[model samples]
Target: MRGLVWDGSELALVDDLLHRPPGPGEVVVEIATAGLCHSDLNPIDGKITQEVPVVLGHEAVGRIVERGPGVRLPIGTRVVLSVFRPCGACEHCRAGRRTACRRTAEPAATPFSRDGLPVQQFVRTGAFAERTVVSQSQAIPIPEELPDAEAAMLGCATVTAFGAVEERARVRRGETVLVVGAGGIGLNVVLAARAAGAGRIIVCDRNPRKHDIAVACGATDFFVTPEASDVAKACLDTVPDGADAAFECVGRADLLNATIASLGWGGRAVIVGLPSADTELSLRIRSLFHDKALLGCRMGSVDPRTALPELARRALAGEFSLTPLVTRVAPPSEAGDLIADLRRGELERGFFDLRGV
Candidate 1:
């Protein structure tokens, strides 16, 4: 197996490796494609803290080559890898909110080994290599028609955007929606809000280059913001009363504040971005008392098994263009350079293709 590994301070590729078979209630997937996301780089670059010697990857799609007991998926099934493992018996899972499961972390599970030492699996999917192991419930079957490259995105970006607008916010028709940041995740938000029937969808970003992409993804309007106050005013002007809902996808405290302020009374704000650890945002308590709600979304708050299929259906129906968001594809060895580029804001919409290994 060849995959990228991150030590506490450095990252490297380990080409000589072996992954153990799936244990009971687990499935072994031969990864065909994986999307390199900023989240993976955050930990490696020390922007986010985590354990070291970890295999870094979460958004992926692969073929199930082996299945253990209690796993219903057959060998050779195409599946999207979900990193979040929900305890089926937990209160949150029982209430149909698997993403909010009380016991979300099920670490100490090994999917990679080198020289007989187990390596940590980042986000639990560990799809940066040829094969990986995941709990049976974490593997969502994808239709055979979708390409593996596109299906890989369902694990995070697409599903997060779909679930946030549809399930978390329950965005209705005729609602005015504002999505902050026009990155890969933000573009998905734009598309999802459009599909949800938002009458006015406005996407805000500091990059002028993303304005075109944002509009193509169904943003009715785009705002380039260096001044949060001006952006808020512009968004309100576009909707007059203010946006019915705002989604913060940049994970910056300042942008979060703007998203909160841009929402109309009774409007809901969903924060889908993964912010830095221990970060905080100040708020005006009195303003929020007017029924303005701030909501935190984790991977869109929907079951991937259900949402991924629906996204695929929409894509097949020509409702969204995966190609527009795919700006770059590189081999696994370029992880270091990719991380550096992402940190420097050089990447727009992109993903790395790992099959080159």
Candidate 2:
């Protein structure tokens, strides 16, 4: 099968790979569609370093083509896989904080491909491959009615934002929220906050093209960073006491700082973006003493089995839409160029179509 491979030197399409069947507690997914996310670009460009010869897609939807021992789901079930890995026996998992599972950082215990070399899974999902193996807990069943392209996104973007707002931040109804960066994750954050009944949702990004898109995605107002004079002041003017919560989705240290500054007294700032290793962020203690909080949210703190289906139901109900964010679609061969474009701020929020293969 043809899949994108990162072998330390560069990322390229490799067809000379071999996939093995699932082992105990694992299931094999024949990927139907995979979205090219900004996170995938991080390791490719050395922004985030990983073991070489790794398959690099973390967000995707697939069909259960094969199952190993101890797995309950039937074959041919359509599913969306979660990037978060939970060890059922871990203290965190036992306490129901699977999002913060104590064993997540341990080396991946499953395998995807083997030949003269073994391939590592990026984020433990590696959905870029034609068929990948994951633990049963990673698979989330989806309704047959949902399109693969749309369902593919719910696995990552939707569930992550939903977890960030609902589980991590605990954003309350009538609270004001400001989401910085209107990319895949940021756009979802805007929508989730709205779904949670946020009173005023303000979105900030450097891209002016996203203004209409943000408002349509539930942003009450949109602000472009560079030209928006006194962004924090402007946001406070809208909420008087400032936004009750702010989310930084771009993963840049500077934007993280700015988002924290935009929060009101007793406000919470959630960092959902994955920043580069060299990136550094800081805040003043005096300001934090005013009851402000800085939080780190991972994959929206949601169980894919639950949140993915709920997000799909909401999209089907016309309450939230992911269509507006898809700015382009291309095959896996074009991935290198797509990553280059995304790095230059040329690609907008959206999915890249790789199903033609």
Which candidate's TM-score is highest? 1
Off by over 4 Å in 2: 227-230, 346-348, 352-356
The most accurate candidate by lDDT is 1
> What TM-score, computed on C-alpha atoms, does each candidate reach?
0.94, 0.92
Residue-by-residue lDDT tens digits, candidate 2, 255-345: 7777777888889999899888788777677767778889887788765666788888888887877776666666777887777776666
Candidate 1 has its poorest 10 consecutive residues by lDDT at 343-352
- Model 1 vs. true fold: TM: 0.94
Which residue window of length 10 is worst by lDDT in model 2? 348-357
Collision pairs in model 1: none
Summed over model 2, clashes come to 2
